[model samples]
Target: MIPGMGAVATTFVAGVEAVRKGFATPIGSLTQMGTVRLGRRTESRAPKVNEFVPLAGLNDLVFTGWDIFEDDMYAAASNAGVLERALLDQVKPFLSSIQPRKAVFDHNYVKRLDGPNVKKGKNKMDLVEQVRQDIRDFKKSSGASRLVMIWCGSTETFIEQGPAHQSVKAFEKALTQNDESIAPSMIYAYASLSEGVPFGNGAPNLTVDVPAMHELSRRNEAPICGKDFKTGQTLIKTILAPGFKARLLGLSGWYSTNILGNRDGEVLDDPGSFKTKEESKLGVLEHILQPRLYPELYGNIFHKVRINYYPPRG
Candidate 1:
């Protein structure tokens, strides 16, 4: 299951269906296309990763997600325009069969976006309970023994780990009191972890990066990961920065700018949401370059990231 069935989520669902139907190849999917070397190099024992490790096949996957917008997966995929119409049409029936559930959303957290399809609750804890119920219903209906939740959601307003995030007890109390510190992403994470479902965060929100979440994950034996999906600019930086550092290259400044018109672009147009993304992007270089280790080469460097929302590009 997923939260925020937007461009990323729809593309994923449609792409998987397309691949399963043999319309296209899973080119960038490591699990589908990658190989792992075993034993000695001379053994020539390289096998596909999926063969080496147990994993679900494309046909075994099922799709469901929550969206503040009321569009079904087909409509959402078309609106995204990430995939060609011809490809989407081939998978239209399959995509159309999937519809998003009402999402847990708040205008305060995602300032630039709002939609009619949203969950209503008396407090944050009530929202959590509602989400938990959604999980149970999906599990029963889908007949899937194990489940995972990937947060393909929008970037929320910048927030820090606070007193409410220090422990599960504190978080529960804060949720009951409708604390402003608890963002929508956190609510989903809390619900998923509580249900013992693995949760993967695909946006730069302080979702599972807290002590309370850590404790919950351990107690429930549910896996949780991420603050961002390094698919674009950050992916490039992670690749190139390490090479630059290995070669002992020096950098004085690095500036990155992007102009996008998708829903993500519009959402990031809000400064609060942009700040969260900025923090995730800016940390990449400092981490790979090891500024503390190579003070002379990296310490004084300036880094700037700017994102401009251009609807015309869409």
Candidate 2:
């Protein structure tokens, strides 16, 4: 299951269908293509990761997601333009079979994006219940014995952990009170954890990274991981920064900029959403370089991240 069936979600579903049909290989997927070495190096006991462990095959996967727009996966993929028309046509029937459900959304959280397909509820807790119901309904209808939720939602407005996020009790109370700090992503995380479903956050929102969520995850035995997907620029930074630090290189400044016209780019055009992404991106270097330990090499370095919404580029 997923929230926000936008370009990322559509492309993923389409790609998986394409791979399952033998149209392409699952390149770069560790579970599918990676190898693991076991025992002693002299043993030469390297095996495919999937063979080394019992993992779900591509055919075993099912798809469903929530989106503010009501488009089915085929239409959504067509709009995204990430995949070629010819490729999408090959998986058209499979893609067309998957349709997005109404999403729990808030215009205040994502200032630049809104759609007709949104859940209506009296309060935040009500929304959580609605999401829980959606999870249950999907599980029964899809006949998925086991389930996992990955949040592919847009970046919400920047927010810090607050009183409402301190405990499950406080969070539940805040939900009833319709607390502004409780963004839509948090509602989904709370609902998924409550249902004992693993939740993976793919956006830089304060979704699962909270005390209340941590407590719920421990109590329910549901794993949760978050804040963003290190794809593109951040992926490169993670790879390069560690090498630079290992070699004891000094950094002066790093200015990163991106321009795109996808829904992600448009959503990030809003400063509130951009601030959330900025925080996630800026922390990468500090975490790897450890400015406190290497003050001389990293403390005074300047880092700037800029994202421009260029409609023509899409």
Candidate 3:
């Protein structure tokens, strides 16, 4: 299940449905279109990833998720305007039937956005329990063998690991006491890991990056990964930066700026929220360039990232 049924999540669901109905192809999805090469290069044993691996087909896959807004998937996708009306209309029956459950959200974490469709609890622990119940109910109703949670939620305010996030015991105490460091995203991660559900973080929130969450993942044998999905400019940076580093090219400065008018852009307008995204985006160059190894060429290089919110431009 997805945590945030916003533009990205709804667009993905609608795209999958369109592909299932033969209206369109899964052009950009690696799982659907990518091929895996088996054995030596001379061997012509390559096959499509779906055919090579024991993966579920598009027709068998199910979608359900939570969102801060009360809109169903169809309405959400329409409001997002990411996909054309004609395309979304073709999958209206399927998309309209998938309604989002109330999400666990907090204004402190994402200051620029708020909605009434949110979970209310006495404490963070209570919120986690409610999410756990939602997972159980969805599983029983869907009759799926296994489940995975992908955090397609908004970026939360920048937060550092505190004493509360050091261990599972400390985390539980903090959750019960409603600690400020525990964001709503963390609550969902904790709940999913506790129930043995593998979780993925699409946004750059410190949702599954802390020691307590890692410990829980290990204990439960639930695989977990991600702080960012790394697309757009960052993807290019990952592809090109290594070339410059390998050639030992000197780099003095790098400036990256963006103008996103989506819901993500609105949420990132707040400085606290921007800091979270900045941390994730800024780390790429440092790690890729490895200034320690190439001090003369990469050390002391300047890097900047600015994300401007342009509502009409998304």
Candidate 4:
């Protein structure tokens, strides 16, 4: 479930539906109909991931989510304004069917948004209860026994580690106390863990990666992984950086820039959010370069990422 099913989510869902309907191919994602090499040139064999593994069937999988706006997925996709008209028209019915539940939102998390479809409560815990109700209702309504929530939502403010996020017990107490450290994404994470559902943070919110959420996941016998699901440009970086390390490429400078008109680009327009993404970008070097190990080669490498949220040219 994409909590905020905008462009990426709609594209993913529409692409999947189109593939299911024999109208298009799953072009980008590796999970759907992706092939893997077997052994060697001698073997000359490769197999689709689905064929190789006992993966859950796509027909059996269900998608449901939350959004701050009341717009259905089709409308959200249209608003995101990413995909072409022909493609959206082709998948309108499928997109329309996947209406989002009212969002578990915090305006403090995303300052630019103000929508009518938001859920409200006296405190963060009440917000959690509403989201839990949403999960329960979605499961019941959709008749889906298995559920996974991926937070494809907007980035919240920068939250530093604090006592409120130290442990599950402490975090729960903070939720009741309305601690400022309890950001919106953290509230959603708490809800998912409480419901015995696995959660993934698609945005760079560090939602499930927090010590509190990680502890909650372990305690609940659920799995959680995030910081982000790298998309677009970052995917390229992951590949090239690894190859650079493998080939011993002396990297003097690496500058990454992107210009696009989309919700993603718009969200990152904020300095705080740009900082969120910029940090995620910086993390690549810290992990890939191993500053402790390669202080000589990577210490001086000037890497900068710039993304301008330009409106669509058309």
Worst 10 residues of 4 by lDDT: 105-114
Worst 10 residues of 1 by lDDT: 305-314
Candidate with top TM-score is 1
Model 1 accuracy (lDDT, Cα): 0.93
Model 1 misses residue 105 by how many Å?
Answer: 0.7
- Name the better of 1 and 3 by TM-score: 1
- The regions of model 3 sitting more than 4 angstroms off are none
- The superposed Cα distance between candidate 2 and the true structure at residue 228, in angstroms, equals 0.6
TM-score of each: 0.98, 0.98, 0.98, 0.93
Better of 3 and 4 by TM-score: 3
lDDT by residue for model 3 (175-263), tens? 99999999999999999999999999999999888999999999999999988777766887899899998899989998988777778
Task: Report the C-alpha displacement of residue 121, candidate 2, in angstroms.
Answer: 1.0
True lDDT of residue 228, candidate 2: 89
Q: Over 4 Å off in model 4, which ranges?
A: 36-45
Query: Number of clashing residue pairs in every model?
Result: 0, 0, 0, 0
lDDT per residue as tens, model 1, 25-102: 998999999999999999999999999898987778887899999999999888888899999999999999989899
Error of 3 at 21 (Å): 0.7
CA deviation > 4 Å runs, candidate 1? 312-314
For model 2, state the Cα shift of residue 174 in Å.
0.7
